[model samples]
Target chain A: MLTTAPTAVGDDAALALWVLHELHYRGFAGVDDGLEWEPTLLQVRGLLEADLERRLRGRWTPPQGLSFVDDALEWIDGQDGVSLARHVHRDADRDQVLDLLRVRSLYHLKESDPVSWLVPRLGVPAKAALMELQFDEYGNGDPNRLHHHLFATGMAAAGLEPSYDAHVDVVPLEVLEQNNTLSLFGLHRRLRGAALGHLAAFEATSSLPSRRMAEGLKRLDLPPEIIAYYAEHVEADAVHEQLAVRTIAAALLDEEPDLEADLWFGAFTCLDLEDRFARRMLDRWGVGEVAA
Target chain B: MSEPGVAFEHPDVVLCPGGPMLLRGRHTVEDADGVPHETTRPVTAVCRCERSASFPWCDGTHKVLPPKLRPA
Candidate 1:
């Protein structure tokens, strides 16, 4: 069924594999739930996952040692390519904002659950720290304060549809593949370090763009509620970056020195995927087409 | 389309056909259908939905939904 190797994003094989992975989370409405555990499906998924992992490893090299987090943070800080946030904040029209939201909804809607799968695989300080960040993501037990809800609020405010998986058919496979990488890392217990590293990179880079996004929303005269999600990230991710780097990353390294390389790979891949996404958006925007 | 880039605001909350309550600034809820219902709450507020792992907020379920469909 895989039509091609995993050399390119949005390849049919990758998309099909991503679709198969969906059965475990929210199976398509009409699909049988029992398919979640079908042995044949598992066999196919395993092969595809292996191919995906092999390709990712070839492209990304994991960092080494407890210092890897710092290096990764520094690398992210040094990045100065096309700023998607700047465009949204300074120049984007309402439609552009809507397009950005739609693309992001592909990820922000589900937020942190994929990485949470690694919690049980972690020990002591790292587990506690990850849980702490996750607790905040979950809204600290308040059903009304969760981050995903905030994202949805922004989505609705942007006038885009906000249903879960509502846009899957339209999203480019690159976006889905970016997310699939996380699911692959999170689901495999051995890859817990990479999962944490990915979270670290994500938190490190989130704050500034979040602020830019909020500014963009405000400039468009969006209501305050819709802007709240981006604003929240401006502050929350600042704190999370530290916890992810020192607590999560450092603790993870202390526990399993061997995982340092994978941790770095996770961080590097985060940067690589985001860069690709940004390029795609900018390229489309330049061509007068909505990138999502 | 209503002229691209034209900003439009709906009522404070519009109940879509689906069950997920969409908050104007807080979160959007979806029902079995893909319709998005809009709601609004305080800044950084949460949503109230059973499927939310982060509760009142989304944890990127929309993205994860696709892969979750995969077996094992």
Candidate 2:
């Protein structure tokens, strides 16, 4: 099944890669659990990861004279990616919003699990800082407060399928690539810098946009659970961003220093992938073209 | 304040430069409206800029403000 599925390029390759990465996460039913490390499958995963990484690296140039760990929030704020949240805030109809929820459910259901891989691989201060942020992400030891579970609750309340990977088939190529990037950075010890960079970028960008999302849901009269999910992030991520950029990512940089470029690369990739996804969604919805 | 090499086990409260005050435990924060809000998480950021739409809790509006308008 791994070698034969028209896995050369585009959505086909993306889906194939996503399924391969899923082996490491929650494997599909009836699949051999040990296949997560099978040599041939590992080779295929490596080739696909290399391809994706090269493509991402080729598109990013580190921001001149800017320090990713120190200036992260401002650097990210300067980025002009198209906003799906803004569109949802003012323009999306009910059907379009529902479709977006389904697409977002791909990542929202899994939430912070990708970065959890870095826990065992980090040094003391960075590890402690990451857990400080991640503990909140995981609902501070309360399962009901867990972010992903919160998303699942909202999904079910919105009358959408709430199970993990339930919307994978409906997701566009950009969405798959976005998921794959997180997995790629998270699972590689060599890319721990990138992983935290990605985490910092993700948290820094979340707070305001989350408020927009909550407002949008309110305007649409969507389920209260769904609105609450976004509302939760508005405050949660404000705290998390400070922890991620200043405490977590900065601590890692203090120890290594050489990973700075890759850290910026990772941060840039996060913004770049989200931009691609947002543009694709907005264009599909006929919202308007996002400037390049 | 302790000497140069000092580090506390865990600083329960931190003032983030140009940002919010991070409180690491639960506390009742009374907003300008005099309504009290109890924190439910391990850490909470109390808005310092007085510009947050969320009021007592930061919604990160401080970051969007001019540097002069931001909290110290």
Could you say which candidate leads in lDDT?
Answer: 2
> What does candidate 1's lDDT look like per residue over A1-292, in tens digits?
5444445444677677878888867778899999988887877777788887887888875444436745666555554545678778778888767777887787788888788788888866677668867887878778677888888876776677888777776666568778788889887898887788788888877776777788889999987877998877765665566567755777778778788777788877787778777777777667332222
Question: Whole-model lDDT for model 1 versus the true structure?
Answer: 0.68
Chain A TM per candidate, in order of listing: 0.90, 0.96
Candidate number of the best TM-score: 2
lDDT string for model 2 (A89-201, tens) is 87789899999999998889899999999999887778888998899999999999999999999989999999998888888999999999999999999999888888888
RMSD values for the candidates in order, in angstroms, are 16.1, 3.2
Per-candidate TM-scores read 0.74, 0.94
Worst 10 residues of 2 chain B by lDDT: B1-10
